[model samples]
Target: MSAIVSHRLHLPGTSPVHRVPAEVKIVCAVVAVFAVVATPREMFWPFAVYAAGVIVAWRSARIGLRWIAPRLLIELPFVVLAILLPFAAGEPRTTVLGLSLSTTGLYAAWGIIAKGTIGVAISLTVAATTSIRELPGGLSRLHVPAMIVVIVVLMLRYVDVIADEAARMRLARISRGDDPRTIRQIGATARGVGNLFLRSYERGERVHLAMLSRGFTGVITEYGAEPATPRQWVLGIVPAVAAICVCACALVVR
Candidate 1:
């Protein structure tokens, strides 16, 4: 049987970024995000510089804006909040387009949009270059907490399984003459959802029992070869170090 794996966000590529160790890329992504976050909101020019660096990383990874742009929809709720900030946040109002808007609010909104976008861009770059399968291994290598790694790995793996099970149940309902579109059928739909959850829980219990019988251990070890070379480390960390330098410059200017 095929493995129950989710669709990977990672794009296939042969770029240097893709070749970098997943652990190194994960570290770099986190460092870059921290650099963006630590920058003062008023340091506008530094934020622009930071964005340029992220774009360069995207280029290196052979990732185009098309792939990254659509995924940004996940942040739509935050975007809406940011858009409303100038209208609703703090004092010291100024007129813009004949409407009174708070100057501090505008600055705060800019900080939210700018820093959030840069952080998301950095994260997308890392995801684009590294497959889902590698993420757990990377976290383990980085010495992340064991419980967190196991949770992440299991979630990634079984989410697809649960989804598939739900789909099959939905099909069965439809075949049995259940019209889920109408309000009259809403109760049935709710019951189906509950049933799906119960089935998923039972499946999980069976899987757990099977794993225990097979002598499964708590640690999810990676069966692989040697560690990342010095060259990979140098290439992987350059963008992160550059981002840190930009953050330092921003602080200095502030």
Candidate 2:
């Protein structure tokens, strides 16, 4: 599980950011995202400040823009939605370079893009620093519901498994001369998806039964990492504190 998550997201760093407890990092990331989301979208400078804070975090974690940029592609669909908003949104429109767009939609798009980008960046930072093994303990320490923690842990554990299954299935299809890139293969692709779902469902059932046989309970054991010291918490929380301050100032100035 750790190997799977580490290969996909964790950067395996020795920086102070990596040294901070997972729970502390989780709390800080959540607080920072809340601060960004709470700030008025019209206040653009605050987002910039929030972005700067993320950059500082990256530096502290010894992660580079090059490393983070590729991962940001996961948010491209939201970016597309943001792009469409100004055109498809209701009236109260303005003309830009011969294109009429909604005034409200413009702000909405900015809000989505700005807030969403910062949120993803913050999340990736946390994922890069924190291992999958640390997550259950972190959420447990944060008093997250046991069921929710278990669900999250299970989801993370199986994501790589499901992904590998999909890859193998795809390879099998390709070997059988099914060209997935062509339009005619759309039907095959859809069938492949349906088959994948059924396979995953069966696997889940088998795993659940095995767990029950082994005296499985709904609760997950807490993570083995020691609790964060006061100093560690303070050090880890500085970015969130700064983000909150920025948000407060943005509200005041707005």
Candidate 3:
């Protein structure tokens, strides 16, 4: 079976951000995220600056608001939780628009929304710029455990395989005059899901055997990845260092 080669989230581009080594991007993203996380929830101004930095990164990557906006839908559930936090959490109550609200909860909710929004934005920016194929090489360069990298590589490769298999099974069921819309037909839908799981498991077994026969090893090695130069590392790390500095300033102000 032909495996999917690219991530659905990856937007192909020739921007300099896209050209930076994947390891650098990973490190930068992680550092920035940590900085965002370290900033006190009460120190709201820093999060705004953090968001502006992310927006700059987006522009540098040639990504636009239109591209980033729809992807933000994935965070809607968390947004809902944030919205409910002021209501559900306990604290000294303050009246807002004649409605009783928790003072502490209001701050907590804002923190969640602000931090979550920036975190998701950063993640989408990275996903938009980085190809799925490059991630394993990046992780490998970070000295991450080989088995973890292999798992990540294989998971990315096989996700589409599982999805395609499920689609084909659904089509087969439809061809057999199975109407999945009826309440009485729920049993068939359940069975189809279970069958799909078993088929995927069997496929995995066969693929493992085939890999072993072909001299497959547990570790995934990428020989073709070019080494990251000192210049690249410097360029890549600047944004993360800047984020850390902003976080430090925010802490000092707090």
Per-candidate TM equals 0.84, 0.94, 0.87
Flag regions of model 1 displaced more than 4 Å.
1-6, 163-196
Q: State which candidate, 2 or 3, has the greater lDDT.
A: 2
**Per-structure clash totals for the candidates:** 0, 0, 0
Predict model 2's lDDT versus the native: 0.92
lDDT of each: 0.82, 0.92, 0.86
Q: List model 2 lDDT by residue over 1-254, tens digit each.
A: 55886888889989999999999999999999999999999999999988888898899899988989999899999999999999999989999999999999999999999999999999999999998888888898899999999899889888889999999999999999888999999999999999999999999999899888988898776646898999999888988999999999999999
lDDT of 3 by residue, 129-191 (tens): 877767878898899999899887778678788888888988888899987888999998899
Ten-residue stretch with the least lDDT total in model 3: 1-10
Q: In model 2, what are the clashing residue pairs, if there are any?
A: none
Which ten-residue region of model 1 has the weakest summed lDDT? 1-10
**Which prediction has the highest lDDT against the true structure?**
2
Off by over 4 Å in 2: 213-215
Candidate 3: count the clashes.
0
How far residue 142's Cα lies from its native spot in candidate 3, in Å, is: 0.9
